[model samples]
Target: MTPARQKLLIVTRHTPLPWEDGAGAYLHDLARYLATDGFRVHILWLAPHDRLRWKKIWRLPAPFARAVRLHLPGALRLGRRFVFLAVVWLPFKARALDRVRRALNTVGLAPPRRHPSPAPPAAAPLWASPPTPAELALVVRFFEKHRPDVVITNYAWLCPILDLPALRRTCTACLTHDIGWQRAALSAPGIAPEITRDGEAAWLRRAALLVAISETDAAELAALAPAARVVVAPKACETRAPFAETTSRSLLFVGSDNAFNARGLDWFLREVWPRLLREVPDVSLHVCGSIDRLVTLCPDGVAFHGPVPDLAPCYRQAALVIVPLLQSTGLNIKLVEAAACGRAIVTTPAALPGAPFLRDAVAVAATPGEFAAAIRHLLDQPAVRAATAARALAAVRARLAPATCYGPLAALLRANAVARHDVARDLRVLHASGAHPPQP
Candidate 1:
């Protein structure tokens, strides 16, 4: 008789959102690949626990509690998770977002409405606060019903729950989209460093595998939690044939309205966009995704198209794709996606944290002058552009197929998910970019 597919449950607060896509794209791809590779993959869209921990809530200023109280009635109408998430994340995000808007407002972009999100409790990052009774119950009930062989968490913050009765026997994994403390520190500077570090370290150490999107993260995470296994697996893009090039010198950029995108776009617009305009007088730059709202400038010859349902049309219309990232940690899915779409890309070193092999395949520049020059050269030289795009597409195909990227992970799961104590033999270095030995 054939054996049944082992069940895998992903406990995460993320779903694939078209607008803010990259953050969750790797998890979606992971689920898809694991399912294709013979596991019954199930996702639990975990939400914020109901009721803020009194220890955390009490440390906050009066208004924070007041805001929670004010939101509770309407939130009760919606649900408990709604109350927790909205009252906690929205106020902080809105306040921080508006602060950014206020700063950029000086640079000509209109500021959004202001809501004062005073300091949240010290040391509290997203699920770092103790999970609520309601949340624990939800997980327990879900586990009872599913009985998954493996429990994979979306972030290290959720790793604390691995000890719960329903999950104690299951092989646990944490998907590090980026380092949690680093992201939290950037998003909420008030969070204490020791708290973030200690909390992240404790839970990251708890996981059987810490799946990072980049090799850089794998190194960092391994150092942070020496006992845990760190595997590098990012989004896998299917490479297509080179797209038809156009005489149109249309440049395209797609990103969400986050600090990374804001910083990069602001820099590109202030420094590089003017130089490109001067060289190619008829050149037009197209901006897509929620980043349209966050950019500090909207100069002439630049157009903002808010989140669109389709990107193939945008990629097809472009002469090139630009990823002028100043700061980011994980694999920039856009870079791989652009390569997969058969478009030549121009980006900075900051964008290649995980996927360094593509440096030769695409144009890379650090400064404004060099970046502008690369974009200008790619625009003027169609043959060179075609050759570069072909190289990028080839690289994506050779290095990033789902099977190739996920094969090691499959082996790891088969070996470790059930009998986790036998880690000695299977814990060999296996890279997500098709760098592992063949089965005998």
Candidate 2:
């Protein structure tokens, strides 16, 4: 008989939505690969990324239509929490609503709240808080009943679930997106509780296996928890067929409204953007995705085209992509995406740790002056830009394809499954001999 597919479950608050953000895209690619490569993938997640879509909701319906769409039946289907969300924030999102909601809840009259409400990505304190006891109870019950061969969770914060007694019979893995303490760099002062190195290290130790998104992140994580098995699996991508390079003098930036994108965009506007325009005055920069909401200002020549379901049209129109990130951790998936799309790029050294193969393929500039010059140089020479874009596309085809990126993780899991099966056989033989089963 053919061997049964190994069962694997992903536990995360950051639900996978390929277009939502880099983390979402990473998880989506991971799930797709696992499902195809001998694993029956399951998920225990909180909410779909940004279910509110506050920025795009107005554009969604004809005037006054969506307001009517938020009726009682809609609330039932979405659960009680959706009703609270619709009333407390959707129609007229105001500071005064906070007072109204508080008064209702204080009198035990709050709207039916049956589910966990979605928080804005990376901005809410909820991102750092551990699940309530009741929530963790549900997770424990599911883990015990399912008894998956492997359990992979996205964040170190969720490692609490990885420590369940059931894990002794399962391979627990923590998918480390980045060094958690590095989040302190992007957060506002006093808003986030101190995320120390020791705290991060402690969380990582709960898992038997650790998956890192980059070599740099893996090295740090390995140092943090020397006993935890660490494997580097860079974010997965598809190698797109070579597309004609754009002659249009437009630059594209795609990101979510998270702190990292906000910080990088803020720095770009304050320091790098003006310098870029001084050289290429007629050139336009098209900003895509939710990151637009985080920026307070959009100067002339820069356009914010909020979140879209499709990025193909945006990619096709831009001459080059710019990633002027001053601070970030792990792999910058956006950099890999631009390369996969065959777009010439002008980026900073900060974005290269995850995809070092990109270092030679794209233009790398360190300072604001140099960054602007690189963009200007690519803009002025279409031949050079196309050649560079071609090089980037080639690099992704060779190195960033899903098989190339996800293979090592797959190999490790397969080996563990065989080991687990052998251990089960030993236990059966011990049972026949009236001997106690060995601890896993």
Candidate 3:
């Protein structure tokens, strides 16, 4: 008889949407890839239901919104203490409210406020959370019911799932996108690096395997978790055939509104962009992604195209992509995406860790003057830009393809399942023979 396909459970902090952010896109691609590899993949996403629900509630009136915003955090904290009781209490209230809502609808007094789903690429059944004891019990029960052969946690933040007793016998892995402590240290002031590192390491020790997005991150994780098996599995990008050249003289910078992106964009606008404008007055910089809310100032020659539904047009029309990140950890997904689109790039040393193969392929500039000069050169010389873009595309095709990049991770998961099964069998044998198992 043919053996049954192994089941893989992925637990993440949020349901990944393709258009949302880098993490979402990465997870979406990974899920699809894993599914194609014959694993019955399921996702357990810990959605922030409380936050979303509160946001919806607050949007009723301006005064009510402000009041709720001020008290929401404290209310949540207090609610957590009595969450079990609230679970019992809220359902009855919810039923009554639903009845009233239905009555209103029957009378044609109120319109429905429901919206359609965002329709994620890999649409796995989701389990959202305010993370109550009851909710955790449901999660534990789900794991018990499915008994997945491999359980992979997407981010370091979701590492707490390791504490579940149901997962004790499962082959568990953690896919660390970056060094969490390093990014946390940069973003949060007054927090010691050692403290954050220790906390992350403690949770990571529970995993059978740890997958880092880059070699640099793998090395760091190895140092922190000396006994844990850590490996590098770089972010994969969908390779595209090189498109025909366009005469669009615009530079593109695409990133979500995060601390690293904000800091980098602010610095670039303040330093590099002005110099580039001086050199090529006709050249314009088009900003894309969730950056509009973060950026307060909009200078001339800068177009903020907030969160485009499609980045293909942006990439195709752009002369080159700029990643002037001053503080970042892990692989830069945007850089990979840009290269995959066959666009030339000018980026800082900090953003080069993820795509080191592209060092010679794309322009690398640190200082504002160097960045401006590189952009100017690329704009003035289309042949040079095309050559650089071709090299970058070649590197991505060879290195960052989904199959090439994520294959190791798939192999590791398979190995972990075999190892786990052997250990369980050995334990059963030992128990039958009345022999005590050896301690770790």
| Model 1: per-residue Cα lDDT at residue 99 | 82
User: What's the TM-score of every candidate structure?
Assistant: 0.74, 0.80, 0.78
Against the unseen true structure, what C-alpha lDDT does each candidate score?
A: 0.75, 0.77, 0.76
- The parts of candidate 1 lying over 4 Å away from their true place are 1-3, 48-133, 183-195, 420-440
Q: Which stretches of candidate 2 lie over 4 Å from their true place?
A: 1-3, 48-125, 186-193, 424-433, 438-440
Candidate 2 lDDT at 267 equals 87
Clashes of 3: 0
lDDT top scorer = 2
- After best superposition, candidate 2 residue 10: deviation in angstroms? 0.3
State residue 102's C-alpha deviation in candidate 3, in Å. Answer: 16
lDDT tens digits by residue: candidate 3, 1-440: 11256788877665354455777677767776777776777766444335334343322233222211111221233321212234455778889889989999899899567777888654422331123454456568768877888888877656667778888777888888888888878876686553377788887887778988888888999987888899787878887676666688899999887889999999999998888888899988899988777876778899998877578989988989999999888899999899999999999998887778988898999999999999999989999999999999999898988888888788788778867877878899999999999988
Ranking by lDDT: 2, 3, 1
Question: Any idea what lDDT model 3 has?
Answer: 0.76
In model 2, state the lDDT of residue 53: 35
The alpha-carbon deviation from the true structure for residue 44 of candidate 1, after best TM-score superposition, in angstroms, is: 1.4
Model 2 is weakest, by summed lDDT over 10 consecutive residues, at 65-74
